[model samples]
Target: MKPTLNEQLRQNIRFTYNEALELIVAMGMAACGEQMYAMAQDYKIEMDPMADSFYEDTKARLSPHTFRELQFFFGHNFLHKTLDFGFYVSICSNPEPQSADDWIRSLEAVPAEWMLTEMVFGVYHDKLEELLQGRDWEASKGNLSLLAALVRDTPPHQEVIHTQEPLLECLAHPEECKLRYMQLLSQFYKDVFIRWKEPLKERSEQASAHYETLFAAKPEQFIREIHKNEPEIFISFPAAFHVSQASQVGNHFLNFTTAAGNVGWVIFGIHNERVFGPAADREQTELFLKAFSDKRRLDFVLLLKERPHYGQEIASALGITPAAVNYHSNFLFFLDLISVKREDHRMYYHLNVERLRELLALTAKVMLD
Candidate 1:
């Protein structure tokens, strides 16, 4: 018999203080952390000043060419498909220590086809096999039109188009891309992350121990708390859950990927949000109201009421840019009134209608009584 989600989680989930893997993610973020903060500021969200200083120092450590290469490879938002490669490396190097040299060697051993597929389409899926059955990676390397065709089939397509240039560049010169990646990792790790290695390792261990205690006591609740934005996955376990070092100060970075097997893998973030599943309190109610009070955000929810929309579509409808939509969406996400879905290798924003109705009833009761 197949195991239940809880059993699978208990059996498959592995948490550790992998310095090498964390460095991969940290370097990727360092590549684009300043840009991320600027985008946040555009939406009126203030980030930690120390994170700003950290990113500035990281930028100073890189040569001009290397810095551009890092941004080109990772993208400005650090959401490039290739970033998933770090997690893939961790998955392979588990139960054994991983080193920086091991990371580059792993990249050398990976097939060009595997790297290209992951880059073109954010994550690999069997359906992609059917889509590109006859076309080989070498042939598709410089084919911009092929990317358009694939993106068209995927819902919420515009965002994927934003990544086409970097994806194509990586495909065209896979070896150069690997070399640049290796250089960025080696240089950044040596200059910036080496001192950080031990401190981050200690934090990861402490966080892992804390989460393990909560998870062993109440598995579902623990998952819900960590995934405050999308609470349903606890009911159906994903590929695996990983705990890693914090990339930015004060804000935990969470990334979800579907690796080679079509199973979901999530790099769980630090637990920082207030628990949302328990009975709603006065503070929670006020938080919900503050979220809805924004006219644009209210409009966003109303648009979702008509049907789920992706970031690009929502931005277009609201006369705002995609970055603005992202900021407003973050608030809606934390409130649990919306959840994210991945379909056809792209992301779509979904409304939790039941959660919305629950809030309405609660608000009405409070006002009338």
Candidate 2:
């Protein structure tokens, strides 16, 4: 018989920190300055005050031009949340780069064409040939309209840029686009690296000690309890899991990379107050009820019940925007009501039947026990 999800987690999950991962978070947040600031301010009750402070301080140090470029490259609707960048970073042979300069070199080694393809097409890059059958990607490599149309129609079930201008410009000079990205990261590093390195190192030590001890003591309990606050952190059953502490991001950020292996990386910025207590049946019941409370979320789950669907398909079926679909999907994902399958780089969502059954049973127990 297959091991239980809890057992799988205990066997596969590990806690550690990588400064390179933290730098990506920092640069991404800094690029997302206003948005990050607003989110931190709005979620201050649950966010670390240092998160906002980190963004503000780092923003003050960068020149206007460099900061704007950063936003264009990594901002949410810009390059579609920088998954292409992060994915490449995670693939570096060296698990942890010794310095910011070393990290830059690793990024430098990424092929210009591959970076451009991944940036524009996202996960579809790997499967473009298969998806298009015999059609050659090279033929349309310079056709911005065609690529944009592909992105528009074949949604990867994640946030993606809708604007065609950035991709259009990049296709004209893929190498330059890549070089400029490296340059901006370098500049961002110079301005902010010194300030961040030590704090991140110290936070890593503190978080590692606290979490590892808790996890070792009760592996099953630790895996189940860390996500007590679904609104803050979400973890699905992954082959391997990584938790990184962030300084500039909001309360929660989740990223997946298949470079070295399938790894689910969840980054949590310093939280001023967080507590993991005994599981509360009432809280679990409330979450179950709340998850189904929204009609859109319910519709999304029901849609997946018919068959696995990508983000754009779900949005089209529900008559909502892709971004809205992503929003609802996150909450469902947090509840583990949906499981993701990646085919050729695109994410497809399937309803988690077992999790659904367990939740219904748990709700019954909570309500009638």
Candidate 3:
């Protein structure tokens, strides 16, 4: 039997640790393409068009300069989004490009479309700028505000605006600004769909297939069996479950719990799961309850420390049912381990790290001894 995704991921974790895993989770397919590109670039490998259709397709829509900028932006976003996982882990674990020249050479080696989005915004950008040049600065700003708002609420407006300030400055008429913004936004959607629709569909299908196989396996049973046979493989936690490689069943190779008590399986060779010490025995369970009143509450604190996640994000990370995340997060707030900030209607939970560490240390000292 092939090692499941979880098994592959567990091995990856052991070798590469958590940063690589987080990169995979947060960046998904994009990060994979980047690593491949970096490796090829460093080794002076030629880029293969067939394998890199995504990057190529995205490049076709832009000028050479803009395309280079886009790559930089994408790469920067990739690193920024993954910063919490730590820098050293990212550098040492993956195959990365050694220099700028290497990156350019690597780009030559990979299939373009595989690494880049299909949508080309260059043509539309020129047209949109031409339209905006006749307008006043205030009108342009208003136009941009309207477009930004529409992008979030309306699915049709998906233009990758390179510089919002420039676009805003070019608009002439206050009333006409809305109309032009709508036109630009609509064109963006149309262009994206036309250029990359098939690839996007394929990507979606691949993701669905990957997850379907991942969620289908019996995660708990796999974890328990691994714990029984390869005891050393499992990482123990005082109040949480162990982390270990599951049987090479299906597409999952490793399993671990979220700070919120949800069990998740990662794809093969993506090691992102944090190992807590061990599952709580009855006595330990009782002690865990006494220390924190609820394990979920403690899990909430962990989630905040792990990332700057909102409720939905926390819920997804923890693999807990949505209702449970909200419920436990409320409890955590009440306990003063976390604070909820309201932006619009969405609430973001930030961890009180000092408080959390103090509590975690106190609890660990009591439980371990």
Q: How many residue pairs clash in each candidate?
A: 0, 0, 46
Candidate 1 vs candidate 2: the TM-score winner is 1
Is 1 or 3 the stronger prediction by lDDT? 1
lDDT of 1: 0.60
Q: Write the per-residue lDDT of candidate 3 for residues 1-369, one digit (tens) a residue.
A: 887645543443221112223222322223235665664453334344433564445445544544343333233322222111222222222332122223223334333221111111211323444434454433543243444332233222134343233223322232343333233323323433245434443443443343334323533334443222232233331111211111011122233344444232323311111111133233333443554677666666666787667778878777788798877765555435678788768888888878766556646655684
Q: Estimate each model's TM-score.
A: 0.60, 0.59, 0.24
Q: On a 0 to 100 scale, what is the lDDT of residue 9 in model 3?
A: 38
What's model 2's TM-score? 0.59
lDDT of 2 by residue, 193-287 (tens): 66777876786668667766666676665555454433212234242223444543222334354455444444544441243333444565677
Quote model 3's TM-score: 0.24
Among these predictions, the greatest lDDT belongs to: 2
How would the candidate models be sorted by lDDT, starting from the highest? 2, 1, 3
Could you give the C-alpha RMSD of every candidate to the true structure, in order shown?
9.7, 11.2, 20.1
What local lDDT does model 1 show for residue 289?
Answer: 89
The model with the greatest TM-score is: 1
Between which residue pairs do clashes occur in model 1? Answer: none
Give the whole-model CA lDDT for all candidates, comma-separated. Answer: 0.60, 0.62, 0.37
